[model samples]
Target: MLFLTSRLDHTDEEVFKIKQLRQLVEKCDELCVGTDDTMLTKFLHYTRWDTIKAYQAIHAYYEFKRRHPTWLARHSIEHYRPLFYGTHCRFVMPHVDRDGRVLVIFKTVDGFQRFPDYLQSLVEMDDLIFESLLLLPRVQEKGITVICDLQGTTRNFLRQFSPAFMKVVNEKNGVLPFSQRIVHIIQRGFLMHVTSTLFMPFMNKEFKERIFTHDGRHLSKLREMVGYESLPAEYGGPASNVLDTDLIFNHLLQNADYLEKLQKYEKL
Candidate 1:
């Protein structure tokens, strides 16, 4: 169970986004961020919350992960996002285990709630998010993935992604690859957007391309790919909830097609 996140929201806006993130990551059962302890202290030492919330964020993720230790199989957490207006993006992607949690955070936020108002609240108040949800024991859970997009981007790409995303933004369609930040914020919202990409490989592909094209210097984009839902809920897993799967389909949409393809590939 690989865990990834994007710190698109620079504003300290909500709590549920992070908490809801906890809920979604229940699959990991052992939350870990994308950074080392030294860096984490340096990053949050200057913040207003005095890094209390920062510590909470880490503990929250770990506690959530601890709940279902058996569910996690492959997990990575990318920290940070590429900012067009400012490189000092306040939305610290945090120190994740895999280092990719930042991007995963961004991907989750954009795909889920479409970056709704509720999501921002989570970032502002981390515990509220957990409070909002009716959580059950690890023994009782649902097969669902919940992501919160605290950052907002109203980009035109939401309407017209390439076959890798929407099928209308392909080079043949005459839609140029405009600056995604400009388009996503204008179309989605400066600090709000959400959706699911498990069943949406095109979206994930385009997202990776954006990382490679926009922030390649600071961040490294992976040439390889993996999608959730293709994994078994119980393979190499603990006897936790089916919802506590090693493979987590983030945000909103599930990757039925990706799952199907994985099966075919396995057979071949």
Candidate 2:
């Protein structure tokens, strides 16, 4: 509760708005005092302190989860080992950035055959990461910064970027509790630009502003924005090695017990 009040200097109108949002969210779904305060605050902040919009966002968030039971259910790292073993998507840098947002890297390679299943795995990984962050009181207020490394991406890989995949991405981007600080697309190519432009209409102005595109020449700019030390070794940073599937899988497994405790606490 102190974290909630400390983050923002609320005016009389804002206080009333927060109270209204809290009541609405609680009516929509049971909220634990410890956990749901932060969750409620996120929705309100995302909607720019607009109670009605926050209510809509809260409703959409839970609705999306309910519709996708596979994404909503309890899933551990072991459950996703096979998918992780085959992909390079993982949360790198054990710490948050200067702005306190968690750094996640999705290195796209050229061997994914089933995009839908892979997309689900990505969603599951995000759920685990976000849930884990929620458990850590210090970082609960932080958002996520996704660095998409499309280095070796080929035409085949780009083919999987279909309308269905884009729909899922847009839907999740719209409703998640935490804000997306940036979806930094590095090593940008023609396909990246083309696809992003095509989907630009789907994103709000705020989200569009957060979508930064950088080429190889702009490594310094990328470093400046995200901090050099937080990046992978391949990106000219201090991280000794690039984060692969195995490293992420192990990291998730290591924190499994703590994450479970936090999740259970939220339900209480």
Candidate 3:
């Protein structure tokens, strides 16, 4: 939406394809979204370089934004400061895995004490973080790997995942113009079973298959998949590696302008 010049070096054929895709986008007068080569390239990559599918994905993307105005709005730092400043539950790592995919981690601390009040804000904040991550050229190219750390999770936290919220999350994940390579769930006990029962129904077949469950003792497997460099010290990475909530928050603040511009693309 910000119309960034593509940093991704494109091959001749890819450049040609992007031009073709751009034409399709321009022709759709109703879309009203101002996208650049980089954004178009992301759609191409998301649809595996098929011009038609990329256009369709673009249409779906804008339609999604139009449908969810609340999520699309309020990406500025001031809007999120009060609600999410101290919240460290979800953030993208500053590192990438061996295959270059970005790492996104979500941990449940205690359940939200004010669930209903924070639900919309929480969804918008998560979208802000995710959208910021997607703006990175490398992240768009390589996609993302999600780490669901359910270590400190409790039944209370689990209960906060309402069906309506899960449905919106599923829809958001589906329409977002990025790939979710895999989701690694780190948990223990019967809670994982209960958690699975509660949320698995909302997931599509491909996403469900992408999830790999690991018990507390099986962190080694997680390390093997994500690599030590990509993880935090708490999860067995280097001693210096840590989850810096401030860093994530600061990054979002830095991109506030970009996020603000994105809101304009939504159909009123």
Candidate 4:
């Protein structure tokens, strides 16, 4: 069966790649049962469809998950909601962009604290978002666009963005099915810029290419990229400034059964 495309309409090239990836994954006993077409495609995309690279990517993914046991604990959305309450971190404007990618806005609020356990919570929260997105068909294929608002960011908060934390994020990005199209850093301050410089070296070339920095002076470029209507009022758009995190939490609740079924096919 053709995994990446519909059987009836799959092209010869698509069929060839799918078969190639499937056969390689099947050879890896641990990856055989859990891996699916969508996941195989994700690895292939990450590795530029090179069979060896794709295999390595798949293995690396499971290995990372094995190392991070907490990520596999299957915690509910509520478990991570406290980390976001009254914080600048949020998923604002529940809508897709012109390219069909989901837009997640993360604003930096005052009183940012980075406890030792905060890194794990951040990774878990990211996984929950990914799980929620997986429930929607074609959403994974389209990927995500992240808007990082750094207006109120302080040196203390920036200092907490350590290399260890970035390594976790980098590893997680590889395993996740969805791609991050762009990480738009808006309203950047001196500290935010310094943080970006420190973290950029650890990221892959593709990820670095997708990182765009912008000051608060004018958001015309961002508006054009994400579409003015899709942005919230704070970002010079018509959408509401209020971000309802519960809406996403409720989404996770409502789609629990569907997400559970999808989990059976996930690689991580």
Candidate 1 Cα misplacement greater than 4 A, ranges: 1-39, 42-49, 68-268
Q: Report the alpha-carbon TM-score of model 1 versus the true structure.
A: 0.18
Q: Write the per-residue lDDT of candidate 3 for residues 150-263, one digit (tens) a residue.
A: 777677667678898688778877888885568888887787667766778998887798888888776898899889888888888898888877766777788788777766
Error of 1 at 149 (Å): 14
- State in Å the error of residue 60, model 3: 1.0
Indicate the worst ten consecutive residues by lDDT in candidate 2.
1-10
TM-score of each: 0.18, 0.70, 0.88, 0.74
Candidate 1 residue 95 C-alpha distance from true site, Å: 21
The Cα local distance difference test for each model comes to 0.25, 0.63, 0.76, 0.65
By TM-score, who's the top model here? 3
Residue-wise lDDT of candidate 4 within 1-268, one digit each (tens)? 1012222344577568868878877776676344456556665655555667777777776676667656642554455556766453767356667677777877665443544566456656666666666444345456678888877677666767788877876776667655446788886657767866777788888778988878777888898888877777778778564566765666666766545454343343
User: What is the per-residue lDDT of model 1 for residues 1-268, given as tens digits with 9 covering 90 to 100?
Assistant: 2222223343443333334344433434343333322223322321322345544544543443354232222211111011101221122111211212211122222322332332222232222111111111110111112122323433432443334433322221111111121111101333232322312343345544432221212211121221232211221112332332112222111323322221121100
**246: Cα error in model 1, Å:** 26
Displacement of residue 8 (Cα, Å) in model 2 is 18
**Tens-place lDDT digits, model 2, residues 106-171:** 776554475456555666767776655443334444567888776666776566667776776677
Would you give me the overall lDDT of model 1?
A: 0.25
Off by over 4 Å in 3: 1-8, 114-116
Query: Which ranges in model 4 have alpha carbons more than 4 Å from their true place?
Result: 1-27, 32-56, 70-74, 86-88, 110-116, 239-242, 257-268
